[model samples]
Target: MSIEKIVDQALQDGYLTPSMEAEVGRICNTASELSIEEYMALDRLMGALLTGEVVVLPRKQFINVMEELVLSEAISQAVEIDKDGDQSLDVGDIAAYALNRLPPLYATTEEGAQYQRSRAKEELQSLIASQVKEAIARNLDRAAQNQTVLGQISDTPLLEQMNILLKAYAADYEPDDESEPSTPN
Candidate 1:
C-alpha cells in the first residue's frame, strides 16, 4: 500500500495520533533537524528492511522516509584484523556492525544483512579500485566532451578544475588494488 494510505490506516487505528502523525511526517521529510544520530537510526531502520532488518518501515517506508529526509549517515566504521592478529577499527566496519546490531524493527538475520552491504565491503576491501581504474580508462573519452563544455561556457571554475583533475587523474592515477585481468580480455 502507499505510504499515505498506510498513514491514514495508522491514524484511523489510533497508532499515529494527529500530533504524532505530523511529527512523523516531518521526520519522514528528512528535515535538517535530523541529527547525525537520527541519520544513523534511519539508515539502520531502512537497512533492516533490506536484510530483513527493520520491518516497521517495512516493505516501503524505505522510500517514504528517505524522500523527505536525506538518508545521510556517519562515514561507516571498520575493523581490520590481518591474519597476523592485529586489529583496527575503521569506518565501514563500524557502520556495518551498527547495521548488523539494529533492533528487530528491521530484520531477522545478520548473514543476510552482511550480504546486503556487499558493495560497501567491496569498496572497503578495495576490490572496486581495480574496476575504477579500468572505468577511468574507458570513460576518459568523455573527458574530452567535458573539456569542450568547460571551454565553452565562460569557464566555470569547477568545470575548469574538473578538466584539470581528470587529466591529472588519467596521467598519474594508480589503483590501490589491481585484479589480474582475465586472459580472455
Candidate 2:
C-alpha cells in the first residue's frame, strides 16, 4: 500500500500495527526517492505518533513459537553436521526454510506461547525434524549448484556471457537502428 493509505489507516485505527510499520519501512528502504506527498504522509504519521494520536504497537508484545522450535531443531542438527568440518550449514537458513513449511504458532501472551509449545511438541516434532532435514539437503544442493555456476561464469568468455544472457532474456532481440550513433547533419 501507499504511504498515504497506511498513514490514513493508522490515523483512523488509532494504532500502527507491526506489519504496517514493516511495510512502511520496506517501502522507504526500497524507494530511491520519496515523492513530496509520501514525505508529507510520513510527517503526518510522525506527528500523530508524537502527539499520542496513533500509538505504535510494540514488537515485543507477540511471539512466533514455531520459530523458536525450528531454531532449536536446526541448531542441534547443524552442530552434529559441523563436527565433521566438511559442511558448514546456515542454521538460520535451515530454520527459515522449515518455518515456511510448518504451521505458524503465534502467541500474544506467555501462557499462550507455552501452550503452543506443548502442542507443537506433542503433534509436530517429527514433522519439524523432517522439514529441517529437507531444508538442510536443499541448502547443500543449492550451495553446490551456486559454486559450479560461479566457476562456469568465471571461465566463460564475455561474448559467450552476452549470448547466454540474450538467449535467456530475449531470444529474438535485435539492435534498433535508432540506437546506433548517427553522423552530424
Candidate 3:
C-alpha cells in the first residue's frame, strides 16, 4: 500500500501493522524522491506514533517451534557436510525445505514453545533428520545439473550454446536448414 493509504489506515485503526510499516519503508527506500503528499503522510504517521495515537504492532508476536528445530538440524548437517569438502549447502534452503514438509508447531508463550519443542524432539526427530537429508540430496542434485549446464555453455561457440539451450528447454525444436527458425505466432 502507498504511504498515504497506510497512514490513513493507521489513523483510522489506531494501529500500524508491521506489514504496512514494512511496505512504507520499502517504498521510501526504492523511490528516488518522495512526493510532498508522501512526506506529509509520513510526518502525520510519525506524529501519531510519537503522540501515542497509533501503536505499531510488534513484528513477531509468536514463534514457530518447528522452524527452530529444522534450522538446528539443518545447521548441524550443513556443518558436517562442509567439513567433508563437499559442495556448500544453503542452510536456509535446507531448513525451508524441511519446514515445508513438517507439521508446524506454533506457540505464543514460552511454556507452549518449550512443550512443542520437546514433543517434536520426542516424536519427530527422525522425520526432521530424514527431511533435511532429502533436502540436501535435492540441493546437491540441482547443483550438479547446474554445473553440467554451465559446463556445456562455457567456452563454446555462441550458436552451439544457443542450440544446447534450445534442445534442453524445447521438446520439439528443430533448426531449419533453408531458412531462419520461425517463432510460433
Candidate 4:
C-alpha cells in the first residue's frame, strides 16, 4: 500500500489529534514566511478546501495567524496607496486596494467570472471585518490607557478632582485589624 493511503487511513481512523495538527501548523508557520504571492497561493488552496475538493485540518490558531498576516500586509499596502499624508483610508480606497491586491480569476464564461468575483469580494470583506475590528479594539484600549495616564500626570482641575475623589474612596476602605491583645493576655 502507498504511504498516502496509509496516512489517509490513519486520518480516517481518528489518529490525527489537535496537538499533532497544531505541531504541523507551527512547523509550517516557522518554515514559510508567506509573501503576497504566497498569500495568493494559499488563498487558492483555501478555494479547494472550501469546495470540499481537498480536506485539511490545520490548527485554528495557525489559520488565524496566517489570515492576520495576510490581512495586515494588505491593509498596510492599502494605507500606503495614497501618499498624501492623510493617514486614513476611505471605503473606496480599501475596495480598490482589495481588488488590486487579490489575484485575478479567469473563467471562460461570464457567469463563472462573476461568481468568482463575488466569492473573492466576500472573502476579502470577511478579512476586512476581522482585521478592522481588532485594529479598532487595540486603538481604543491604547487611547483609554493614555487618557488615564495623561490625566494623572497633567496639572489640570479634572486631575485634581479625580485625585480627591480617589483619596476619599481609598479612605473608606480600612485595613484588616492586626490586634492580638486578647491572645497575648
lDDT of 3 at 144: 78
User: For residues 1-185, could you state the per-residue lDDT of candidate 4 as single tens digits?
Assistant: 22233334434553544554455456456764645654554455456456665565554431222233345645665455446444344433334444444444555555765666566566665665545544544444555655565556555687687765566547566555775345655
Better of 1 and 3 by lDDT: 3
lDDT tens digits, residues 1-185, model 3? 78999999999999999899889989999999999999999999999999999999997779999999999999998889899976978888889888999999999999999999999999999999999999998888767776787677988899999878767657477768878866899
Question: Model 2: how far is 76 from its true place, Å?
Answer: 0.9
lDDT for residue 35 in candidate 3, whole number 0-100: 99
| C-alpha-based local distance difference test score of model 2 | 0.90
Q: Which portions of model 1 show Cα errors greater than 4 Å?
A: 1-8, 17-110, 116-138, 148-185
**Could you give me the TM-score of model 4 versus the true structure?**
0.25
Rank candidates by TM-score, best first.
3, 2, 4, 1
Off by over 4 Å in 3: 1-60, 162-185
TM-scores, all models, native as reference: 0.22, 0.56, 0.59, 0.25
In order, candidate lDDTs are 0.41, 0.90, 0.91, 0.50
lDDT of model 1 at position 182: 52
Better of 3 and 4 by TM-score: 3
Better structure of 2 and 3 per TM-score: 3
Please, what are the lDDT tens digits per residue for candidate 1 over residues 1-185? 33344444543453434453455567668665756665564454445446542223223222222111111232211111233333332433333333333322222355544544553444433423333333333343455556665566564687677767676547666556556465674
Alpha-carbon runs more than 4 Å astray in model 4 = 1-70, 77-120, 123-134, 137-141, 154-185
Runs in model 2 with CA error above 4 Å? 1-60, 153-185
